[model samples]
Target: MTAPPTAPATSNAVGRRVSWQTGVSILVMVCAVYLARRHWPVIESGAARLAVADRGWLLVATAATAATWVCSALAQQGAVARPLPARRLVAVQFAASAANHLLPAGLGAGAVNLRFLTRCGLPVGRSATALAVKATAGTVVRGFLIAVLALACPGVIHPPHVPAVAVAVAVAVVGVGVVLLKGPLRRALRAVLADVRAVHELPARAAALWGGSLAFASLHAAVVIAVTQALDLPLPPAQVALAYLAASSAAVLLPTPGGLGALDAALALALTLAGAPGSAAASAVLGYRLLTVWLPLLPGLLALGVLIRRRVV
Candidate 1:
């Protein structure tokens, strides 16, 4: 009698859980459709531009976009001493990119990678630490690239002049924010530093971490540059690269999913500042987004779903 009651109870719990998952999936699909409809005009315009783009240059952009996933996989592998399955790692990065765009900032990608690491035998805490280390390396490499490119293309990205009072206020605000978050920040910093040290102890890991990060950022810039070339945007390659790096860095501040609006606006503005016409700048930005985001999105999501069903991530 007890067994019969327990069986129905277990079935009910499982049914409820499945129903909840179905509801969430439906909600996500609805939101995605709504967003697509809202941005239909922009999507149409980008598609028009891409339709006439130089095939050779567009091919280059596509290749670079694909290589980015491989680079990302390399960086993730570098985040820990243990060897991960290379093929699965690359596929997970592709899926993670789609996941990343679905959530604000990088929460989705981080969660996916965390799950992957845990599934690969890493402890939860260690998995989180590895993510932090990979993120830190990427950040450092991006900033370095920006600084170098800015110097190379002198005057390409002019910093906005701020009033002394505004600068002082910004500094004060940052100081206060730091003070308030000091405890948690300090603990996090310690963990990241510890992981950084451990990862650096292996020369191969260090090289993969830093080198992969460099390649990832550079390839993204290359994609933008290739788009500009394909469209005959009348900007030097170096200037375009500089504009992309600077705009992408600024986009980081907004924390939008996939840096959607923020990156689009910033890249357009940067390209315009770099001497491309408004229409050309817009086309370049759209083309870049098309290749990087829209094209890969469906396939990446499919991969994510497959990984989930297989319990791979």
Candidate 2:
């Protein structure tokens, strides 16, 4: 009699599991369809623009794109107290790039990295702090590069005339107010500050953190330059780099999956404003996206799957 009752319970548990799995599958399918429909125009335009770009320059852009993974690994290593496995770390960065596109505002990448770091034996809190540190370093380096380039080519980068600065200040003030009001956020901030201090105490890690951050931003800008050159865009390389840094940095405020629409629009607009023909600007933007986002996407996804199967991420 007891065996018969247990069998029904087991069957009910299995049924519930299967139902949950089916629901999740349907949700994923819905999301996929939605994203595809929404991004179709950008996809079509990028394809058209890339069809005419010089293939050789595209290869250089692709190469620069590959180097970004190494830079990211180095930066991540600098963020934590313990050293991460170098080979696995680089692979995780590559995989994270693909994951980054699947979710809005970098949640996918952060989740992947958090998993990887925890698997490497760090506690969850420290892993999150490491992410925060790397992000902070990357933002600072991008801003520094933009400033330097703007000074180098003042004629290309016009002064800011809009009330954007005031708006940004107001936003910062509001953010600070919120942070102060939120207890959990306050604790998180304190932990991040502690980790920042710990990481800065190690000279080698400090250098790697800042150097890798700078290199990552520079390589990204180099990718843009290669794309522009491939299209024979007449804009100067410095101007292109400056525009890329500024546009991409600004695009961070509006997080769309890998900055798909936002970055593309900003890049094309910045390039045109920098004196490139509209067609050339579009071509360059398309080529850059092709190398950085589209081309590697499949491989990155495959790598993500492999890492999951191997239980590496």
Q: Which candidate number would show the highest lDDT if scored against the true structure?
A: 1
Model 1 clash pairs are none
lDDT: worst 10-residue window of model 1: 23-32
Error of 1 at 138 (Å): 1.2
Model 2: which residue pairs collide?
A: none
Looking at model 1, how many pairs of residues clash? 0
Total clashing pairs for each candidate: 0, 0
Q: Which lDDT tens digits does candidate 2 get at residues 75-140?
A: 999998788999999999998887788887888789889999999999998899999999999988
- lDDT of residue 119 for candidate 2: 90
> Once superposed on the true structure, which residue ranges of model 2 sit more than 4 Å away at CA?
1-52, 159-176, 179-182
Reference-based TM-score of each model: 0.90, 0.83
lDDT of each: 0.88, 0.84
